[model samples]
Target chain A: MELLCLEMDTVIRARPDPNLLYDERVLQSLLTIEERFLPQCSYFKCVQKDIQPFMRRMVATWMLEVCEEQKCEEEVFPLAMNYLDRFLAVVPTRKCNLQLLGAVCMFLASKLKETRPLTAEKLCIYTDNSIKPQELLEWELVVLGKLKWNLAAVTPNDFIEHIMRKLPLPKEKLALIRKHVQTFIALCATDFNFAMYPPSMIATGSFGAAICGLQLDNGDQSLWGDNLTDLLAKITNTEVDCLKACQEQIERVLVSSLREGRRQQQQQQQEQAGPRSKALDELDQSSTPTDVRDIDL
Target chain B: MCRTMSINLSKRILTALSNGPTRRNLFGPVDREQLQLEYQDSLRKDLEDASRRWGFDFLTETPLEGGDFQWEGISGTKVPALYRSCMVGAVEVLRPRGASGLGSAAAQSGKENIPRTPNRDSLKPQSLEKTPEKTQSNNQSNKLKRKQTNITDFYQAKRRVVATPRKSGQ
Candidate 1:
């Protein structure tokens, strides 16, 4: 009876404090304006021989899975990917070390974003014990050094909340749109093709894509007219043409990502294993033993 | 030829410094305990402040760890340099064992043995301007007195060296 009373007496304080909400101007300033912060490498032209575009995708997927499994904060994975991309831009890392790099980046990012940061031991476990805590500790410095220790360099997720706040939608629809935007942002993180675009552009484009997808699913195109586009472009300070191009790319990836996710889900069911088992197997198969040996040199 | 020769000379000096008695193994095991206590005394407040305000954590929070301390929070434009400087400062004041070990090999390490010889090359111009002729002469005389002994002798006698007679770090 006492335990039941204590359970009933528990107070819920799960919601964010309204007083600590960020100022709109601060959010706008947090958006990456200068091209200096963007990664220099593209899919066609990369300085690192070992780190190909697909490798980035695989690592991003792994990071996303880890974040989801651990129930990390919303901003952790994208911020981690930002650090990974920026670090890879300047430093040519080995393929074997790529997963270690990813783990360390997320470790750094979670520290920055999560109240309870991901532990080094847990991150090593997630890597299937391929790396150790000491290795992660060492590479954290290397990644931080290569990134010039600029861990808070802006990411698309930074602008998502700001953009969502500006849209004229009800609370329920706004929540739905926000969810879609997060998916689009994650998809963009995996693809190196999106690296060239500014984070603001990506955020704006992802938001636009989300609205379109949500509206179409509800059989309502009225919410996505020219006025809405203009409003989004104006809010993000993006040109309409560039915004359209980015939105198109985002939608394209969103479709394929959805399909790929579904296919993987089916495969996991067939294999009767955890979601990560097949992906890890694919990663091992893709990087042949000879390739690993070549990277070590 | 001179540049290469200077490089080789510096390299030999560095190797010598590397092989010298470190604070860790100086008194054998007890030195480490003293060094750890000193490190905590000097760095405790600053580390706690940095950890609370900026989310930075000490590298020694875990055992058998190497490299710079990790940080959290939104990293600022000046943060990397600030963090490096803070670590450098902590290292300067407390003299961590790992940093001493690596500082010998990574020639760019700015923190090791700063009290003994304060990077006269970089400090020359500013110090020359700041320090008057009389003190400068006194420093030179002191160096002459100190130079009769080898660098190792200086290293050995460093703990007993006083700050009032010669402002070495300054």
Candidate 2:
């Protein structure tokens, strides 16, 4: 059935009207907007080839920070991403203000998923007051209309929770597993390629495969590899691509951060010496005012 | 022979009656007598079922007066009165099999048949009497007037709220 669906989708893509190309253009424009607005976080310099994984790491770190600060559920982040993806699917790029769009998506998802909802004003303030409260509210309506009032979204949290329920691991190992899964999520955001994959697949495949890979790398290859192979067979190509992109981005960001850390250290040392040396040179020049004093004598 | 033909014709008439009316007049007065009869019959069946399920005697006494109903403790505590009332109302509306059979017999003999024309007129609103042209113009005018008010209020409220904070802060 999945193969049939894929075949149908391919056929639909192959025979499309000129007007249908608008969706592709819109997708490209949105991607461009994301690239321009969010960019590769400072970690891009270290691991250039595997930037997506680093991006996911950044996102996971940010999500943890936000969730902890607001006392909101961690699930809200993935829910927000789901809304953003579905909204992007339908709403034409030209009709949206991307910044407002992003913020509104987050705001709506927070309201939908979180047990305790944040007020529109609070969310606006949280975004550094970049947008007015009224504007945020207005964007909320615009977003709802554009997405035709679709509020339900399956999130990475749901996928992770389901997978965890099925796994036969102890609580301590499960906790470690969850942490790795979240880390993979942060890495996912760095990769442009990951945007095309459905959010659930991205979450499940990355975490599931990462756990398997981690186990294998640590020399516990026998059991996990078989389990992972079965898991991978069930996953779609799109999901695998997304996982690969996320992994690549993560590796890239790690490498980039390492380089950035070194560069920062060098810059700090130079910065410390720069002012002192200038002051000493000035003192030397002043003490050499003896030539002028001798001439005066 | 003439008597036999009349009997055959009456038999055909009875068959037609058995089929009932295909289309009902909507605007006429509701058949209250029929409704009441249906409700009573349903109440009786429900009481019977309740008695049977509880291993109690349904026909023995006046059940409405609240004797020690046998099912009271067996069904995990006594049923709430409001829930009982709701269930009774639903059964009344639904008109179960035995209830419908008894009620229809009463309805066939009842004298009050609501006129079809009155029912039709009552079903449609008097506003629909307007000429199609006038109705279209009136709808368009109403829509335009409503649109103006909505847009004005929407913009004014938005501006007022947003402006107040910046003006005070500045």
Candidate 3:
């Protein structure tokens, strides 16, 4: 049996330029590569159109929930996004298992960004033990290798922070704006156009778009008058179609939450009445018979 | 001629890996030795570059029979044992300076200075300074004092730690 060990010297030579910035051309090439690789297999086809939209939203929501639950930093999200992008870019679709892909991305991101990382076993348990710990570990290495260990991608959060500094908003308002934009990021998976936008561009565009949506909804158009409008327009083209698509996705997620709340309420109401009605029905049926016979005897 | 031959060989290997169909067979036994040598050469170059960037010599020397020892590469100096001891002493003296800088900085700031104490009370709405004006002013003052104390304690502790060893020896 021939054993292969990577030469450490070659490994060092393979180390990517840490300061290499992702240009628009590089970004486009990555997106094109992903498109080519995805439809190559059955598994890739499974997440192609409508199914992909929901999966993307679910993965995004799960990432946020996991971050919040573990008290992990928000930096983990961008790292996760980068991992997801790179994995999708390189690993052909046929080999893709979205569940494993999501878990692996989260695992890699957590390791990169968290000061103290959650172990594979702990993450498995957190994901309801659906994915085995060993599988996650293996997939992490696979994802890392496919990415060529290049982890220097500009993320959406970087863009948002820059815009927030420039925006004349209080900390709380800035946070609110961030939240609104993040809600839109969940829809980024739906469009291949998202792959073309730099993370910073996406973030700035989404934020400015969300602010305008809120202003219009509140019937305060003047709130985002000339200067902010000109600035946002310059940062992002701010097309009506794109903005509406983002807003609709955000509304869909919010509406889904509202529906879930209503469903829970209805379930609770049914549960509360279920036993009482059963007892009442039993009482009505047995009211006049067996007890009287026993007493007479 | 040897250097040229090696460079040519490396280029051929790289091209084979990147574009040639013979990549799977490129790392055969014959090529393995060549690859190993090339790798070592690359590592030596990297280490030399790192040493220069860091402004330190990593090579150590040994005493020879005739009161002379050979030194490796640039910045060659003898007195190996003395150099090692001095480095250890320098690190020991520097550590307390770093700790005291952090400690005094925390103390000089009006905020509670207890390290690693997770203050749950601060999470309460009532304890938080909600007004932007007051919070900004408080943070500014704390930062100013913290900076002043950090510089002062760093030098003071460095002197103390270094002086203590000398005094004990005396």
Candidate 4:
């Protein structure tokens, strides 16, 4: 007799252990070490001469697109950005090598975070093969060496669950809250200004912005305005004044990125002569980032 | 099912990537020779820095003069069988590749054996930044297990490099 074999091949993710997410020590320890992992300096001023801030944004946007298209775990993009920031903090990389560095960062982060890590071949293809697989592998060691072999640096994403578990968010909107928080976090990663901020602050700021965007803070006084900032600051041990500034920065970034995304989308539509309907534009506005001209920060 | 979904996903990626703006190279053509030269220079500088900081020559697997670390090497026999990648006994060839397991980042690297040189690059990129005191006294056996070999050797170990208090992480 022949037997039919059957086993689902879905990615096996561990359930969030309460021991990790709920334990006070886990959260506190994360806050303590989060600063240690931030890039050592505002690299554009001192360490880098050939590369500009805009170049970093260009690579970051591409990296985010790759992560999104490949369905990489949420932490992978942020974690890779951490490595990129840290490496740039030290190494004066040439502009020509920046994309190679980005690919190497993604390659390392995927290996660290994914069940099936992305192959070097695949990453090269994503760069339109501007970089070879051999180059990616060779640079991986150089990047690793500069990182001091510390691949486990704490990222803002680490604080998400720790912060969320403490928030008074409605149970039904937990998933939506997480989605927005992650999007905000990714946006911050792409921006160079947030590069030097503590991961906990970014996580805290993203949480504040995310909560506001989804309007999940309705009917709760403790979750509104200054009160919400105080609550978030308390959770992450960030100063209230600083947390307010970071959240405002995040909001500004969201508006600008939304505009940038739309500008590109509109250009593409014009080239094809397929004018997008206003109804569709409004629908799109509800979802993507905007970098419009008139949004006041 | 996941495989089929990935196949569909990859197919979509292939078509979009042909002329997709997302797929273009950001920085024009790279000077491959200069990049390779820089890679070599950077690796040499890193090894020298490691040597000075640890007081051990990682390239030679030996101690250096006037270094922070006091280097001592026990014979392979002196080290426990568990720490050795291949035991001297019958288990040499048959050891499962996953023996190092996950989170053991690059543990057992041969990369540490590359020949070293004095620093060559005039552009000292990150020398200005201060390295904090190496506070964490990581266990000896733990350090030996997940060490890096050359880039070509292994991707076997998982979380080999834990985020310890050692800021510069050499």
Instruction: Specify the highest-TM-score model's number.
Output: 4
Candidate 4 structure quality by residue, lDDT tens digits, A1-297:
999855433567899898898899998898888888888999999999999999998899888888887788989999999999999999898999999999999999988888767778778888888999899999999999989888998988999999998888888677767776777788889889999899999999988887776555677788887888999999988999999899989888766655554556656666676655656666766765343123321
Model 1 ranges with Cα > 4 A deviation: A1-24, A32-36, A216-222, A262-297, B1-170
**Every candidate's TM-score, chain A alone:** 0.79, 0.57, 0.59, 0.90
Predictions' DockQ, in order: 0.01, 0.01, 0.01, 0.15
- Tens-digit per-residue lDDT, A1-297, candidate 1: 355523221223357433333576665566545356688775236568766777787677777767766767767877898888787876665676678778899999987776556778778777767676766776676666567677776788778767777777666566556666776777687777887788888888877776665553344443555666787899878899999888888766654554344455456554797665776666554553222112211
- DockQ winner between 3 and 4, please give it: 4
Clashes of each: 0, 27, 0, 27
Off by over 4 Å in 4: A1-7, A272-297, B1-19, B57-63, B66-74, B80-170
Q: Which candidate is the best by DockQ?
A: 4
- List lDDT for all candidates, in order: 0.61, 0.46, 0.48, 0.75
The sequence of per-residue lDDT tens digits that candidate 2 reaches over residues B1-170 is 33343233223222222212212221223234543453355456556756655557657733344445533323412443334434555445544433444334334433112111222332244422432334334545676687776767989999999999999999
Put the candidates in TM-score order, highest first.
Answer: 4, 1, 3, 2
Off by over 4 Å in 2: A1-68, A89-96, A168-170, A208-227, A232-297, B1-170
Where's the lowest-lDDT run of ten residues in candidate 4 chain A? A288-297
lDDT of 2 by residue, A160-230 (tens): 55455444555546655665565455345334445555555556565554465345324444226445434
Root-mean-square deviation per candidate: 23.9, 36.2, 24.7, 16.0
Off by more than 4 A, model 3: A1-60, A89-97, A130-132, A170-172, A179-198, A209-222, A225-230, A236-249, A260-297, B1-170
